[model samples]
Target: MADKHNDISSTELRANTPEQAVLSTPTDDIHVANGAADKSKNQKIRKATNIILIVVAFLFVFHLIADRYIPSTDLGRVRGFVVPITPQVSGEVIEILTTPNTLIRKGQVLARINPRDYEIALFTAEQNVTQAGQNMGALTANVTAAKAKVVNAEANFTNAKVQSKRIFTMVEQQVMSEADADNARAELASAEAGVASAKADLAKAEERLGSEGENNTAVKSALLALEQAELNLARSEIKAPTDGVASNFRLKEGFYANAGQPVMTFISSEDVWIEANFRENSLGNMQAGDKVEFALDYAPGEVFTGKVAYIDYGVDWGQSEQTGKLAQTTGQTGWLRQSQRFPVTIHFDDEEAKGLRRVGGQADVMVYTEENSLMNLFGKFWIRVVSWFSYVR
Candidate 1:
């Protein structure tokens, strides 16, 4: 009976298959559900895209305003005068008076070389100077005696002129013979010859002693050598040039310090400044003397005050130094170029920043170029926020 009913149902379904079917199969229901699901998915995608666009736009607008009014940069460094301490005179380091990371004052003795050798050099120089002076003084006395002889000769010549004139007058008046006049003329000529001879002797003496005269080149050279020796002896004891912290010390007792070679690095605390790289667009109103706020990575939750000491006119990007040859410019790979950064030097207004500053340390800086209350307030708050963020940095 079931088989007969199934056969009858199949025949009825086939007969009503054209367009008059009252019941639907499960395949058609599945197609309709898939269509609804696809439409819902597309709607969700569009909504998400709109939300993302809105967020991006908001961020762009916020950045533009913040950067324009309050120019701030995280690419900042705590900078100061980093002096390389080099010994002016070379010697074996006998004593290291300065410890690493300690504050050093200007002119403080940092290290001492084996000063015994320098002391010997100084003594030798002094002795040589004294000997040269004594030798040159004897030669100088000869020249002085020669000059006196010349003066005496000139005086005798003058006296001979007067005597010759008197003798000529006596001969002319017939009171003396022509022989007396001739003898007077002969004496005058002899006196003139004596003067010439004395001058020649003086010249010869000067020429002989000039090589090592009292104030001659040799004496001057000896004096200069003596001065140089003294300077070298003083330099054996190395002194600090500026107040700073001695760091990265590479010297110890028994070490040999070469002349003009750096032994340690001195990070000068004097004139501490921040070198902040800022985008060109943000520097529209930025210039020297502008008020600035900054923070350091070492001191989190603390902001420092400063001013724009100066702004770099340009950067050295893609630039080669003068080498007497044309620079072969290299082509960039990208279709667009990135914004260039200029260094803005900020000087500390408060002494606290100078005390806490370090060379090449990380910093965040904000320059207040304009008088916008909103921007200034935001900049102050932003710097503090950055300061707190340094805890993680």
Candidate 2:
């Protein structure tokens, strides 16, 4: 019975010993468990890193595809012929007919120079022409008078020659004295000199007369001066060149305007376009006549349609009228280079856009060079996004 009791105690001790070992565990086993937990944490970190890399790669590829298929740019401007309103002739501003920022029709008078000076010039030119005509008439009369004088002098010369010949014959026949014949000869010589003088006066008169009627050189020159005076007087009105709006109108009633100097800003509304700057790499499929869409900064949440007019071929970064200078060195010399941008002209499909044109206005543009539905849809969404973002901007 004691041996049996001993065996039962040993069995219970063995079972309790296994439970104690499980509760207390060795340092080596604890280290192993800690290492396993560390491994599991490392695996979780690696999985998160891989997911992030995949997302980044996908976004990079998507950007490449979108950029290639449907190129978009926020660097766009509403471009038109913004001309400087310069006076053809110089004068003091006497009156302004046009109001500020008003629509002016073609050939509408914008302002007027002091016409008193031009009026005086026109009057002087008219007087010069009158004087020229009067002079021409006097010259014609002088030619007629000179011709009559020449004929009279020739008749006298003929009469003197006949009388001298008769007197010489009479002297030779002993009917007249030598003194009388000498007197007749002297008269003949005098008559001949008078005829020569009269002919010279007639020639002088004819030469001064020039061509007949309006063909006269002096008359034509006077007429030309008169025409120029009229032109200058008309130019003093300062009419608008085309149908458009005016700006920067600092011209006043007393301002002195110089010839060929800009006094006001006039933009032509006949031709309007969007000058969009697009990245060079994204312009692979871009060509003229491609469809386009854009949004103006002023008109937020509005999408306007257009067509690609043309793509610029060159950039004049270093070109200038000034010369004899070395080229400027590039600021960056790293392996990565900044992308080059080229201008792409776009024409609005909306006819109302022309009437509502504003030069130098900011815009966001997108060019669809191909019929890529997915990419184009993305582009449309992108531009509308920009249009909505314009409100925040």
Candidate 3:
């Protein structure tokens, strides 16, 4: 009975020891606490990510709204009116008075053609004018002499008629011979012919003299030719038509310049402007007088201000390509069609445009619309950032 009792007590002790060891172990509790801590940290991280995504989405929407209202163009260029220097008259270039890339004033003599021929022509024209004046004087003298002759002829004719009439009367009274009466009739006929001849001479003299002595047809024609000769002489000296710089001037002393051919290019600095190309969809709010900010590659990091001067009304899309009488359509059709860009002219501020010689230079432009919003400030900031980058790019 004592051995059985000892064995049962040992078995109970072993079972109770195993249960106590399981309850007092600290490894399971440590694992459960670590899991709870990991779950809490994950929850916090997810919350932060969700907040960040929401903020980014909101900012993106705002940016879209701002960009939709404010139009901008990455493709812009400095433009100005290019004046082609063309000669009006054809001649050999005898002298070039202007140098290439030199500033010239209006009416300044740029070059000279061979003026010897023109001078000779002018001299001939002057001689012709002098000869015409002498002829006019001679014609006047002739007219005076003819008028005097006409007066003398009229007097002689009257005297002859009177004498004939007296003779006829005498003959009728039987105091004169019949031969004398026949001779008197013959004298009357001669007097009538003399009177007609005198009247014709007077008419001829008046016709030659014309209404005004100095304004005779021949004299007027000669004077017009002289004026034309003088004009041609003056045109032989080519003159600048405007205040600008002359470019591409390759004319020398002996080159024969053709009439109406462009010899050089004149770029007018006073009429400089910018031509910006904007997408068609971005011009909904654009109007004349809108403010513009632009950056030129030549003037990097400097933002120049300008105002919208005009918007092109016509574009190539609406233009019809004519194939004979039929209007062939040139409209583009594709899944990824390119957006058409139209030109907008911007006039720079006079003060800011000074000292900038960037004609046909690349530029980036941004147009600020009338719409006001908080995002517009951001848009301006972005533009400023781009301008800053322009320094390195």
**Which candidate ranks first by lDDT, i.e. highest?**
2
Clashing pairs in 3: none
Every candidate's CA RMSD: 7.4, 6.0, 6.5
Tell me the tens digit of each residue's lDDT in model 1 across 3-28.
Answer: 99997787577556645344455577
Candidate 3: tens digits of C-alpha lDDT, residues 44-151: 999999999999999888756665677787789899878887887678999888897777788989888887877888899989888888888887887888788778
Q: Write the per-residue lDDT of candidate 2 for residues 278-356, one digit (tens) a residue.
A: 9999899889988999989878898889999889999866545548776666686676688889999999996845555
lDDT of 2 at 142: 96
Please tell me which model should have the higher TM-score, number 1 or number 2: 2
Off by over 4 Å in 3: 1-60, 67-69, 205-214, 318-337, 355-357, 371-385
lDDT scores for all predictions? 0.86, 0.88, 0.81
Give TM per candidate.
Answer: 0.73, 0.75, 0.78
Model 2 scores worst on lDDT over the 10 consecutive residues at 19-28
Which residue segments of model 1 deviate by more than 4 Å? 1-58, 128-140, 154-189, 204-219, 319-337
